[model samples]
Target: LEPLAEAGVDAVVLGCTHYPLLRPVIETVGARMFPSGLTLADGAEATAAELATLLTERELRGAGPGGLEMLVTDLPDRFAEVASRFLGEDVEGLAVKQVDL
Candidate 1:
């Protein structure tokens, strides 16, 4: 936060899927750290919108059930717990696997 403020950053983008969860904390810190007005962009929302547009343009929208597969480099249980928060549902029975790079 300090470095970004020092660098005169005007905006911060939440690029990762989990990053939106930290938006409030990040905004609070930015408010304290940044002298000028800072704009926070939600990349998750932008990505979702773009994906929907692309699907519609490509005529690839699906009408069937959707499946999600998660792969983690480490800590599958912790990832599942955190992912459940983002997904707004329990991921207990979801297929999550830990893989080596």
Candidate 2:
């Protein structure tokens, strides 16, 4: 926040999945630190919207229940917990796999 404020950033693009969870705090801090207003862009939301559009345009939208597969290089349990919080549901039963990068 301090670095961004010092750099006089006009906008901030949240590129990480976990960053959105801290949006409120980041915005508040940024507002206090920045001389001008700071615009925040959620990459996840944008990505999801674009994916939806592509699926629709390509006629690839699924008709039945959708599924989620989580692949991580490390910490599957922790990832599941955090993902559950973001998804607003339990991810304990979801398909999760850890792979070497």
Write down the RMSD of all candidates, one decimal each.
Answer: 2.2, 1.8
Worst 10 residues of 1 by lDDT: 13-22
TM values, all candidates: 0.77, 0.84
Indicate the residue-level lDDT of 84 in model 2. 88
Return the TM-score for candidate 1, rounded to 2 decimals: 0.77
Task: Estimate, for each residue in 22-87, the C-alpha lDDT of model 1 and write its tens digit.
Answer: 888898988889867789999789889999999999999998998988999879999988888877
lDDT of 2 by residue, 1-101 (tens): 88888887889999987799999999888878876799999999989999999999999999999887889887899888988888899997888999998
Q: Which stretches of candidate 2 lie over 4 Å from their true place?
A: 85-88
Tell me the whole-model lDDT of each prediction, alpha carbons only.
Answer: 0.88, 0.89
Clashes of 1: 0
